[model samples]
Target: MPHPPPLGDSAGQPGRSNRVLGRRGCHLPILPQQDGPAAPLPASPGDAKLQRAKEALRLAGHPGDPQSLEAVGLMLDKLAKENQDIRLMQAELRVILILPFLSLAPQAQKEELETLLRKSEENARLTEALQRETASLQAAQTELRLLREKLQGLGEAGLQRHRRVCPAGGAGTGPQGQVPAHYEGLAAALSTFFGSNGTFAHDRLSFVDFLDEVEDALEELAELLGVSKEDVDNFEEMALTQLEAAPWGR
Candidate 1:
């Protein structure tokens, strides 16, 4: 095998010394080519004109018989037309492949949109239900408060009745100018009960339970005042009769 020839050497050119510096700073020898078949030179990458010519020849894809300007121009034109046809075919094929997915796109979008709408409707319904429940709870709380106030008013009225009958330093007394110790005790008990346990007292008693306690207190008052059961019944009947007789009450 023959060693490669030096740079700038060709078949026609005579040998000449190219004094290149080696890695060790010595002058390297560039020998001339011995007679035989000359090796094909490697194309330089930086030679843009050469590369373009070679690429044109490759695309031309035919022997350069009777190589002329006209012949070369005709080959390159044919190659350019063929490349254009290939690119058009590729573009058409891309459109063909993508068409099916494009056709189904609307249905997919519709399903997604319907799902979102359904979710939105469900959220609205839940929100409405929550609002209704909140309003109902508030109304119930208000009604309960009014009932408690009414009960408290009734208790205050009972206390006032006891005070009027007793008067504080025994000013006016029932029948005789005398006050019963039991009657005084009952008044004291009423005061103690109302004073300690305020309106909405501890234990959170229900309206019915609180009314039962009021009834018990009234019974104690009647007993201590020495009022007969018949008198209490007559008084209750008379009160009811008066309410029924009134036009507003009826």
Candidate 2:
């Protein structure tokens, strides 16, 4: 390597000079004119490392352009330099730790490292894909819930229309109006079980809790409708089976 330029002119100039190469051979911007001593280097390990790399590159006749191999050499050189800096020691330690493994099978080292790199890249790609899938699943669940609400609203509207056309408590009707006796009984039971406010009034329930609520509510409804416990249990089982058969449920 060529000898670095002298820190200053041998004869010395009229004004004092303060210059240091930044990382990647970049000429650090000139500091502001100071009345006194120059500011100290960054105290942070990361910042100090970056500064050292740049200074090393400048000494090697390379501008601090990190993209260049010369700049990379400066950084690698820092890690190899004899220093008590904790950060540098850790970097060297990592290299030292891996040396035994690399030397054990020099011929296969390249292949093994390449395989490890490929697997790491694949793991990153899979992690990103999984995140996107999770977002899509959440969106789908929201849409499904909204659709269920709309369907319930429409069903209620249809029942209202039926009541308007058919007089309440008519010869063939239940006391609760044109709505069937069983449906009315079930509705009352649902209101009691679900806080009597409305369906899904509370948003804090977990999925398991919601399922349990549905089961208990159904039992209460069956009792009100004079339906057998066995029948309700069988219906619940069938509903779960259908759910498992659906792609989303799975």
Candidate 3:
């Protein structure tokens, strides 16, 4: 019969027995922590180093610094040509910084920038249009003001001339060889009702209407002058026939 196995051993025999115990099975070993002080982390990469170098140059305030006095003398000799290089470099750096911001900026900020540009363009257009409109309105106002001033300067004799030249209402006379105050008031009212241009076109139609309204006034004037309404009507008919013969009447 086989002997019993020892504790922590499986049939303690020799090398062949250790193989039977499975000590050489696929098991991973635990690595030890590094000994002594740790090595410092590697320096920043080339790009970062370059950036730092540029920053240091800027801080040093020696942008025009050269590799040697000979290089400096050469740059000084071609200073005007070298000056444009500094401006070009600045422009290139601005573009580099601006490009990343443009790419990474929020969508809303981009839209707002577009909206601001559009609004500025629209505002400029509107401002120009308003300036033109204002000039036109000012010119029109000036013309109207001048016309009103001319009208205000007219005397009674001037008004009589106006009535004779542009008559809508009849030029009936009152007592003592004077134009009736009512006739002047009526003519002014008619002139105001129909503007300067409209007055001539609407004269006959407006006069017929005015005659009907001031019939009583006309009758009173006729009685004062000892003339009959029939006589006045006959005179009006004859005048109408003559006016209807004109080209405007067509």
Highest lDDT scorer: 2
Q: Which ranges in model 1 have alpha carbons more than 4 Å from their true place?
A: 1-103, 106-111, 171-250
lDDT of 2 by residue, 1-250 (tens): 9975555533665453466566886555567676988788758867866777777666666455545656667568657664548777898999999888877866677898889999999999999999999999999999999999987886666556444544466665432324333444444544433443333454676647767876786677545444445656654554443334212444
Give the alpha carbon lDDT tens digit for every residue of 114-143 in model 1.
899999999999999999999999999999
lDDT for 215 (candidate 2): 76
Relative to the true structure, how large is the alpha-carbon lDDT of every model? 0.60, 0.61, 0.56
User: What are the root-mean-square deviations of the candidates from the true structure over C-alphas?
Assistant: 24.8, 27.7, 23.5
- Measured with C-alpha atoms, the lDDT of residue 208 in candidate 2 is 71
The weakest ten consecutive residues by lDDT in model 1 span 238-247
Alpha-carbon runs more than 4 Å astray in model 2: 1-85, 89-105, 168-250
* Predicted structure 1, TM vs. truth: 0.28
TM-score of each: 0.28, 0.31, 0.30
Q: Please, what's the RMSD in Å of model 2?
A: 27.7
Residue pair clashes in candidate 3: none
Once model 3 is optimally superposed onto the true structure by TM-score, how far is the C-alpha of residue 41 displaced, in angstroms?
A: 47
- Per-candidate total of colliding backbone pairs: 0, 7, 0
- Return the clash pairs for model 1, or none: none
Worst 10 residues of 3 by lDDT: 13-22
